[model samples]
Structures are given as structure tokens and as C-alpha cells.
Target: MATNAEIAGRFEEFADLLEADDVEYKPRAYRRAAEHVRGHPRPIADYVDDGDREAIEDIDGVGEAIADKIVEYVETGEIEELEELRAELPIDIADITRIEGVGPKTAGKLYRELGIETLDDLEEAAEAGEVQEVKGFGPKTEQNILENLEFAREVGQRQLLGEARPLADDVLAFLESVEAVERCEVAGSIRRWQETIGDVDVLVATEDGEAVIDAFRGWDSVDDEIESGPEKASVRVGEIRVDLRVVVPEEFGSALQYFTGSKDHNVSLRNYAIDRGMKLNEYGAFDVSNVEDEVAGQRVGERVAGETEAGMYEALGLEWIPPELRTDRGEIEAAANGELPDLLTREDVRGDLHSHTEWSDGNNTIEEMVDGAAAMGYDYYAVADHAEGPGIVGGMGLSDTEILEQVEQIREVDAASDIAVFAGIEANVDAEGEIDLSDEVIDALDVIVASTHSALDQDAETATDRLVRAIENPAIDVLGHPSGRLLNERSGLDFDATALGRAAAEHDTALEVNSNPRRLDLWGSAVQAAVEAGAPIAINTDAHQPSTLEYMRWGVHTARRGWAEADDVINTWELEKIREFLH
Candidate 1:
């Protein structure tokens, strides 16, 4: 059966194709339906598989037409209408539009005028000066595409952590049920909680390697078998490639440590070990201090540690480093000195201060969203709906009057709610680094998460200055999705993190690590820089619906990757403490 995410992805593609085809109004409707489909708590495919069309349509924003298409998809494993759209364009619309300035409409025009379908075609056209010759495109546009095409192609090869992690969890759950598998854990960049990963790597410990491999091959989500052996196998799951390796129980820890690495980190750690007469590898850590002819083999010396990851670190006289901090950025030294940060965990967060409701583009009402937050055991929640500005379109943004009206409603809901409902607005930052809201509206909001939604192509210096200026504004409490980057899509802004952070710290404005999978902005390195500069951080879901509020998990891991401690994230503070910070 198709997963909710998979079903929603098809509709997203449907919307993209329709927009590329220049179909009016239908694109937004499809996208809205797709959002609700993705955020719906229950499995939409289950209802379709059960032949209950009414149940499928019961989901918000899902009408009868979409219900029929979903049923077709669940039953036949394909939707005829969507397939027709693909056949009509016959272009890699999604990949092509990944270019910085290229949207679906531009993609459709290019396909029609230049017969461009793939990145190769686009690059070829740009290189031959043919793109500039097209009526609407100019030399600058052609150059921009040429400059950004490589980045786009590279992005296509990697999957977002949010998308791949769930699949990894599924694989783990399946492996745990196999009688022959003794132990299993994810490794590689996925284990490190990297923002993006190339593939999923699973390491299992089992005496019966063949049985483990056979059981893995039998998993239902396995889309295709790429290759298999007695102790290892690689398979294609959906679009992702999952590699599994089976080892003896004794080698499981060493294997996991060796695989769950940033190459630089491993190289540094190896040199550090060698300096102490020790050698480390996948098999085990060995003390070669008294051994002669040390180059004989991996087991030339007495084994010091082999069975547990923490023991491996203990043998090195260091603390066990979390996987997220395996970035080789002084983490080894920090661990050796017992100075590694106590990274913030999910439970440390007291509330989410960035969220949306029906006042803007969100699907839920303020009351419904607050109830959802209360159910999640949050002490507070903020309704930061979009304010009228650039990038937010189609009457989706609230005017001054609408914002004040929403604030009143939020307060009314807050009066009866278990959690403190803070009134907020996701105000747009113009090119000049100024929010468009009036002082009255700004004052009324408890939190103002100002973000750059337009003119994202500003140069590094200008972008940094713009962000700093926004930070200097007293009304702006956080700079949300600081770079405006959409993973695998727009490259968004370029800025100096240290400068942005220092300015944020000076002005008491927090930096946000947006939890929306599409935009995990202020990514690990940038977050590190900001935190180092003493800027407060906010890991918010930027959730548009109740189900998406659960996105806080991704945000927490991302913050950990940045080395953020509980005190660094304002959302983790008590209600009174956060209120003081807001003031």
C-alpha cells in the first residue's frame, strides 16, 4: 500500500505539472489538497484500499474528484489523469524547475520553445547560446541557469533527511521482527542526522547472515532487488537505495562506528589513536603498544574494545560523542576534554512559537491548532500566520485589519486553553529589510518571525546587511528560515553567519531553524556559527496543520547537529522565561 507521504507526493507532482501546463486556478487547489493529504493523520490509502470513497473525501480540502483519482492510484497503483499530464509534457518538470529562478511556467515555455526536457537539454541549450535567443529569456537568464544547473543536478542525487529517516525507521522495524537478526542499526550520514543523505545504510549483527539477507529481501516496502550476497545486500526502496551489511555480534559496534562517520572525523580520530599506539577499524580497536611487527594484520595486537560504541570511546579516554556531532569540527577534542555540549533533546522544548492557522495559508482554525498543541503537552504555542507581503500570494496573507482580528481570536482561545497561546505573525521582510506591519499590529503580536520571502538572490554582503537590519528591529523576535532556502529547489540568500548571529545577539532577536522539511534553514553549520556568537535559537515546526506540528522531531535533531544546548533555544525555556525574552 502507498504511504501517506507517497500519495501526497503524487498530488504535488500533479500540481507542478498543471502549473507547468499553465492551467489556471487548478494548480493551487491541487497543491492545497496535497498539503492536507500529507498532513492528514490517518492513512488515506487505507480508506481507498477499503473501497470507501466517502472516507477518503472526508479529509479536509479533498473533494470527490481528488477522491476518485486517489482511489485509482490505490487500486491500480497509478492515476490515469496524472499519467496523461506526464505524457503531455514528457519533461522532467520537477528537476528542471529546481533551478534557482526557473518555475513550472518557465519550464513549460522552455519545453515548448526549445524542446528542453532534462537538465542536460537545458544545459545544452544554455551552452549553445540558444536559450538567450528564445523570445522571453535573455543572456543573464541563460547565464544564471548555467551557473545553477550543476547545483540542481547534485541536489537531485540526495534525499532529504526528513524523507529518508522515516524509511530507515521502517526498515529497522521490519528487521527487528526477523528471528535471525540479533541487532540492527542505521549508519552513514543518516545515522549522523545530516540534513541530506545519499542513501540508507543498515548494519545488522547475526550468526545467520543469509537468513538476515533473505528476510530483508522479503520486506514489503522493497521496490526492487539490486544485488545480494551471503552477508550483504543492496536494494532499491522507492527512489532510495538501501544497503544492508551483516556482521558477527562482536563486530557490530566497531562496524557501526566506522560507517557512521564523516570521512574527516574518522581520519582525525585514526591519527589521534595512532599517536597513542592504538589502531582502529571496522573489526575492532586494538592496543598495539607492546606488539612487534605491528603491520602484520588488523588483529595484530590485543583487542581493547569491540562490543559497544561507548566502550570504543572509553578505550580512547574520551566521552561517547553523539552521532550528530561527528562532523570533525573539534568534536574529538571536545570529547577528549569532557567539554562536548549537552545537546537539546525533543523533550526539552516547552512550546512551538512559529505556526500557522486559517487566518493565513494554514488549514486549521486557531482553536483547533491550540487544542492540538495542548494535546502534545506543550506549555505554549504561537499562531504566526502570514502577513500581507511578497512571495505570499492569492489573498493568502492577512491584511492589518485581519491580523488584529486574528489576534483577538487567538487571545479568546488562549483564555480557555491549557497552553499559553501567543499571538504572532510571520511577517515578510522586504528587500530593504523592513517588515510591512504597522506598529499597532506589531505591538499586538507576542512574537514576530520576520523572514525574507522575496529578492532572495541578493549578494552575500547585501543579504547579511539586510538580515542584520531586520535583527535590529525591536518588533522582530526571530529571523525565520534565515536563508529562505528550499532544499533541492531555490538556493535562496547568501549571508555571513557570524555577522548575522552577532547582530541577532546584540538585538536580542532569535534565529530560527525552521522544521519544515522543504526548508531546514539555518542548517547545522550556520546554526553553530549563530549559537557560538551567542544568538538565541528557535526550532519551530512552521507547521501549517495539526499533524505537521510533529515536525519538531526533525527540528530537534537539526538543532543537535548545530550543537545547540537547551539554554540556547528559547522555546525550551519555561513559559515565564520565554515571555521575558519576548519582551
Candidate 2:
């Protein structure tokens, strides 16, 4: 049976192809239906299998035409119209449009004009100066396509943190069930909470390495065994690659520290150890000061520290740094000076400032979302659903009158609820940096999250200026998803974070770290720059459903990776303090 993701992917491709074929309204309808399908709480396939076409059509933005296609796909595993369209185009539309400045229209144009059907063909055309010769495309455009080709090739290899972390948890649970395994942890970029991860790395401490390896290979989730040895193994679990390594209980701490590395951090620590006549590796930290043989291997000299990560760091006269802080971005120096930040944790988050309800492009009601927040023990919650604007489709954004009506409903819900509920709007920031809603409507809300939903391909300077203008708006409390990037799919904007951060700080505006797995926007580096510029951060889930509220963990870790302390995030403040800031 097809999952919602698979079905939504088909609809999205259908939309892209239709738009490329120059079809107008139908493409928007398909795209909107695709978005709604992707976010629907229940399995769309289940509805189809039950022979309920009305249930499928009842989904927001899905019409009868789309419903028929859904039934055809679920029953036959194919859609005749989509296949016909694919046969007609006969090009890799997705691959071609993934280039930075290229869209479906441009891809279609290039294919029609130059018979370009693949990235290789496009690259060939660009290299031969044929692209510049095409009407409506200049030499600079050709150069840009060439420049971004490498990035396009590297785009979809990594999995999002939200997708990878759960798989890691499952593997950990399996390993923990083994009696030989004394300790187990997931390391590498996942441990650092990078938005995208290449693979899941698991480290284990056990008396019997062979037993652990055998158990891992025999696990039910293993799809294919890539390689196996007495102490290590690599296997494919579902769509992700899982790498496992086992060490003795004595070296577990050192092994964990070594494997939970950003390569640069390991290099820096190794050099620091060399300077102090010590050796550090996966085995343990050792004192090589009195050793006669300089070329001696891993366990060659006196073992100075091997029991704990803190011991390893202490051997080098430094404090233990958090894994998220181990990116070699001055973390070693900070540790040496006892200045490592008291980073923000999941518990520090008091409320989410950007979230949605069924009022606009969400899966639940205002009361359901409020209950979800209260269940999470939040002191306050903000319902900041989409407001009517450009780039918002299928009537998903609320109108001015609708905004006022929703605010009244929010008040009624709050009156009966234990947790404080603040009504807000995720106002669209237009290309010129103006909010879409009227001033009267903006003033009526308790929280205002201004975000850019369109015009993402502006030049860096223009993008920076646009965000600066939005930050300068007194009514805007937060700058949502500063770059507007969607991990592995679109590079949303190019802007100067320093400029935007400085402007936001001056205007008392908070920059949001949007915690939706796909859009961990205002990513760690940007967060670091913004925080350094004296701008406060707000780690929001931007969640469309109640279950997604748990994504707050990803946001909090992303903030920690940015060196943000609890005091640096506005949402970590008490309700009165947050209210005061809003005023």
C-alpha cells in the first residue's frame, strides 16, 4: 500500500509536469491537493481501499478529479493521465528544475528550445555558451546555472533530522535489549542535531563484540547487510544506512567522544593533545611523554584517561563540551577558558510562538492545539495560523474578518483552559517587506510572526534589505524562518544574516528557528550570527499538527548548536516577561 508521502509525491510531480506543460489553474489545484494530502492526519490510501471516494474528495483542496486519480492509483498503482503526461514530456523535470534559479517553466523552455532533458545536457549547453544564446537568458544566467550545478547534484543525499532520529532510536532500543551491551549511543551528525544527516552511526560498549554484531545483523529491520566483521558492521535499514561499532566497556566513553565528532573538532583536539605530549583516539587518551617509541600505536603509552568523556577532556586541561557545541567553532577555546555556554534544552522552551490550527492549513482545531500545549505542560501557547497573502494557496490563509473571528474563538478557548492561549497570525512578508494584513488586524493580535513565502530568489542585498524592512516593523514580534529554506528541497533565500540580525536587535524583534524538520530555517550558523548580534531567538515548531509539537527537540538542539543559552531565546522567558516583550 502507498503511504501518504508516496501518494503526495505523485501529486506533486503531476503538478510540476502540468505547470511545465503551460497548464494554468489545474496545476495550482493539484499542488494544493498535494500539500493537503501530505499533511492529512489519516492515511489517504486507507480511505481509497475502503471504497470511500467521498472521504478522499472531502480533503481540503481535493476535488472530484483528484479523488478519481487517487482511487485509480490506490487500486491499480498507476494513473493513466499522469503516465501519458510523463510519456509526452520524457524529461527529468525534477532534476532540471533543482538548479538554483531554474523553475518548471524554465526547464520546459530549455527542453523545448534546446532539447535539454537532463542535467548533463543542460551542463553541456551551458559549457558550449548555447544557453546564453537562448532568448530571455543572459550570460550571467548561464554562469549561475553552471555555478549551482554542483549544489544541485548534492541536494537530496541527506535525510532530515526528523526522519533520521526515529530510526536511530529504534536501533538504539534494539541494541539495548542485548545483554552483552553495557551502553549504546548514536553518534555523528545526528548527535550534533544537524538538519540533514547522511547516515546513522551507533556505538556500543560490550564484553562480546561478536555477539553484538551478530545480533545487529539478525535484527528484523535489516534490509541488506553491506558488510560485517567481529567488531563492526554496516547494514541498510529501510532507506537509511546504519553503521555499528563495538568496543570494550573500558573504552566506551572515549569511543563515544571520538565517534560523535565533526571532523574539524577531532583534528583540533588531536593537535591540542600533540602539543601536550598526549595521544587521543577512539581507544583512550594516553600520556606519551616518557615513551621511547614515538610510532607506537593506539594503546602504546601510559593510559591517562579512558573511563569517561569528562576524564578525557580533563586530561587536556579543558571542560567537557556538549556534543552540539563540538563543531570546532571556538568550542575548544571556550572549554579551555571555562566559558562554554549553558545551552538551551528542550525543557527551557515555555511555549511555541508559531503553530497552526484548522482555521488555516492545519490538521486540528484551536481547542485541540490548546489541549496539546497544556498536555505538554506549557505555560502559554500561541495559535499563529496562516493569514491571507501571496504564495498561500487553496484559500488556506485566513482573511481579515476571519482573523478577527478566530481571535474571538481563541479568547473563548483561553477563558475555559488552564494554559494561556495567545492568538496570532503568521503574516506573509511581501517582496517589498510589507506585512500582508492591515495595521488594525495586526494590532489586534497578541503575537505576530512575519515570514517570506515568495520571491525567494532575490539578490543577496535585496533579500537582506527586504528582511531588514520587515524587522523594522513595530508590530512584528518575530521574524519567522529568516532564510525560508526547506532542507534538501529548496534554497529559499540568500541574505546577510548580520544585517538582518542587527536590524532585528535594534527593533527588538526575535528571529525564529523554525523547527519543522523540513525547514529548520535560520539554521545553526545563522542563529549563531543572529545571537551574536544581540538579537533574541525564538525556537518554534511551526507545527501543523499536535504530534509535530515534539519537533521542539530538534529546534532546541539546533539552538544549542548555535551556542544559544536559555537567556538568548525569548520563548524561554516567563509568561509575564514574554508579554512585556510583546508589548
Candidate 3:
């Protein structure tokens, strides 16, 4: 059955569509309730069944009217108001507006004016040059629509992080190999681990900016040149757009600082620089109309962004800000108070907590997984592929009998291997929050990672309650990817993290920071919140193949955003301590 969380999530999507369509206030109300319901601790249907709609009334922005609608939807499997709204619009609003620049209002307008209800219709109209005749849309806007429609049709969506990170590494390696380039770093959303990336931004510092630009355009992956300039160059590599920005060696630090931005962070920093009678840009900050009259914005003077990132901070009379903490979260305030938690580093990670093998869907076997971990210098590794249940598509997970048999093989590997091997299972959490594996089997494993694999459409209350129950289970060692979101592919589940984090802490269950670039689960803010609630984190690669084990760098970056320290992570502990944690 569709749980309360699932229903609420659908409503939330409808609400976003309504907002895009510039629907009435009720759409916003539904969205607000969806957010609140998704975050509520109790199962929403409890209140609905009890004839007390007030169950979620206390949810911020969810008043009596919205709660009653939720109750009505739960009982009858239909929300009257939503049905009415759909009757009026009755369009696949999300599909039409998913194009880069198209919003809900535009989608609605397009639908109403020209009956354009799908990407196909929009593309046909754009190609026919009929869209330029729309009320407010000009030829330029029509051109943009045509361009984006073609791009969207060809590329579908931004490349997944799993696919993009290795490409980033390859480019970085190539840039480093260039003798003229002094330093280089990835900047923008890819660095931020945003669910989707529009383009890949790379900032390079070189003695010869022109030579670096030429080299970038000549990159082996470059299939076509989009633009070539002294400081910046854009190229099309297959379908992905790679943008390279080159700066002089003297200005490298400033360029890095300017480029490695959360836009808002850079804006705030630039304002701070302006206040200090300086101008900050790709070129180093300069004293413009300064009291001391040093490096003016117009006339470049001396480099001040280097010496250390801290020096950049010293110039602004602020403490150094870590790249991950630059999200305009509490970093500025935390830096001011000198209260930032020392974030975890790759060195602090002693082992990988989650891996897979040929026994399940993984390409590598236990021995191969162990050797891969050992090569990466990990002291211990866990082989926790799918355990019999929902997530094991095509009936691939290990059955209870098979799991017991696998335990012996795992023991054999552990006994023979130099590094400690943890026998574990990635058990599925059913819609009701119950794990598929028996307690006897769960207890036998060194680690039990309970994950949600099916019925992803549950309401927030049901999803949260389901998860809360799973976390409370003593047999379940960690709640893997608490949100169950799969980047651009899927939004796994919606639940109250505050409640889940509390339950996890109460049960002493770790929350996984899944290191798979495609699924950096328990993302930055959630990790921070979980850490604050005293829930230890497990940075697991969930590696299906040997090559994937190295994706931990992106996972570490994700954790650092939460200001997670080595002490806050379970994998940072020694094998003995990790065993104690499991027990």
C-alpha cells in the first residue's frame, strides 16, 4: 500500500508543479504540509485512522485544512482538492518545465496558449519557429528554448557524479602534467556534490595562461571547441561541457578562491573586500581607492590570496574557511567563534565499512574486494552486498540459507586475509520498517546495514516511522543512506532526519555516508545533524566493482561539508573499536 510519506511526496511534487504554474495559494499549502509531513516523526495514517487529523496539525505551516486533506487522502486514496486542481490543469507539468530555462508558469502558459503539453510538442513548436510568436517570448527566448530542447533531448540530464568524478580526475591529472600549469582545482557544483551538474568547472594556475588555454582546447577528450579565450576556454567532450579557466601564477590563489565559490559565498566575500577598499576577482585582490594605495583593482599590484588559504582569510579579517564549509552554512559564524570541528581526512579513515562481491551483484569476489581495500591501505573492509529482499532486483540477493553459507566463506577469507574482514549484509527495510533478514542471521553478521529498497512512494510519516522502527532494531547496525535518495535517478524516500537521527543515536546505530559518487547518501547537512545528535557516521563506498572503491574521495568531501571529523566517523576507528561498535 502507498504509505502516508509516499502520498505526501506526490503532493509535494504537485505543489512544486503548481508553484511553477503559478497556481493558487492552496498548492503552496500542500507543499508546505508535504515538507512538514515528511519531517514529522509519527505515521500520518495513525491520525487519519483515529479520525484525528490533528496528528500532523502541529507541523509548521500545516494547519487544520491541510491536515484534513491528508486524512481524506489516506482514507479514500484520493485527495478531493488535488483531484480538482488536476482536473483544472490536467497536464504533465513537470515534464514540460524540466527544460533548462522553462518554469511552471511558462509551461502553463505554453499549454494554455498553444496546447504544448510535452517536450515533443515544445520541440516541434520551437523547430517550427512558432514559439517566438508567444505573448512574452521573443526570438532570443525562442532560440534559447530550441537550443536547450536539443541539448536536453540529446543529453537527457546532467551526468551522474559516478560518471563525472573519474572524468574530473582524468582532466586534473592532465592539467597537472602540463609543465606551465602550477596548480589546478575543480570548482562549482561538481565540487559541491550538487545532485546534478550543468557543466564541469576547472580552475588552473599557470605561468603561461595562453599556453594553458591552448592546451585545454587541445585536450584528448575535446571533441569540439565551444569557445577559446585567454583566461577561459569551453569544450565539448562527448556530451559533457568542460570549462577551463586559466589564471597567472601570481593570481592563482585569488583565482582559486574566486572560482571555488558557492556564488553566494563569493558575493559575500567580494562585498567584504569592497568594504576593505579592495577588489577580489580571478586575479588576486587589489587595494582599490585604498587608504594605503596598494594593489588597485584597475592597476594590478602584488599577490595576497596565497601564502595559505588562511592568508586569504587574514586579508578579510576572517579565519580560513574550508572549501566544504564555504556553503554559507554556519561556517562564517563558526569561523568567527573558532568552533569548527576538525573535519575528517582520507588518512583518518582506517577501513571501508561497505563493499560487495560476486556472491551477490558485485563484479568482484570477497578476496578481490579485500585485496582492493588492502591496496588502498585500509586496515579492514566489510563485504555487505544485498541480503535477501526488495532492493535485490532480479532476485539476486542472498537467501538466509545462502547468507549462512556465505558467512563461512567470509570467515575463510578473514582467516586467510591480512586485513580484517567484516561479514555483513545490506538487508532491505520493507515499507513497514521491518528488515527481511531474521534476527539470528543479522546477529551472526559483523555489520547489518538496513536500507530502504522498495515502496519508495510512502508518505513522510510512514517512511519516517518505518525507518525509526528499523533503526530501533538491535540487529541493524547502521541505517544506510537514511534518505535513500539516488541523486538524479530517484529521490528514494522522504522522512524527518531529526527523528531518524534521534532514533539512530538512541539505538547506537550508525548512519551511512554512502561514498558512491552517484549516492552520497546522508548528504552534508543531514550528516552534520546526525553527528550533532551523537550518531556516528560510516563512510562506505558501497563499491560494486574494484574501480569504485576509490570513490571515497568524493564521500570524504561530502562529509567535510558537514564539518565531520575523524572522531565523528566509525570507519576512522581501529578494527577492534569497530568490532566493539558492531557488538
The C-alpha stretches of model 2 lying farther than 4 A from their native spots are 1-156, 292-294
Q: Tens-digit lDDT track for model 3 on 75-148?
A: 78887877776776766766666565577788888888888877889989988888889999978778777766
lDDT of 3 at 206: 75
Global lDDT scores for all candidate models: 0.87, 0.87, 0.77
Greater-lDDT candidate between 1 and 3 = 1
TM-scores of the candidates are 0.75, 0.74, 0.76
Worst 10 residues of 3 by lDDT: 290-299
Candidate 2 lDDT tens digits, 1-583: 6655567888988988888888887877787778667545455776776888888888867888899888889888999999999987867888888775688888888888999999999999999999999899999889879976876776645789999999999999999999889999999999988888978999999999999999999999998776789889988786677999999989988998899997668878999998998999999999998888646677988898877878899999999999988866678999999999989888988999999999998899999998998888899999999998877889999999999999999999999999899989999999999987787787789999999999987755677789999999999999999878787788677666677778889999999999999998877767887888999899999989999998898899988988999999999999999999983
* TM-score leaderboard ranking: 3, 1, 2
Error of 1 at 382 (Å): 0.1
Give Cα distance to truth, residue 306, candidate 2, Å: 1.9
Angstrom error of the Cα, residue 40, model 3: value is 14
List runs of model 1 lying over 4 Å from the truth.
1-155
Candidate 3 C-alpha error for residue 579, in Å: 1.0
Per residue, candidate 1 scores C-alpha lDDT tens digits across 174-239 of 999999888999999999988878789999999999999998998999986767898799887877
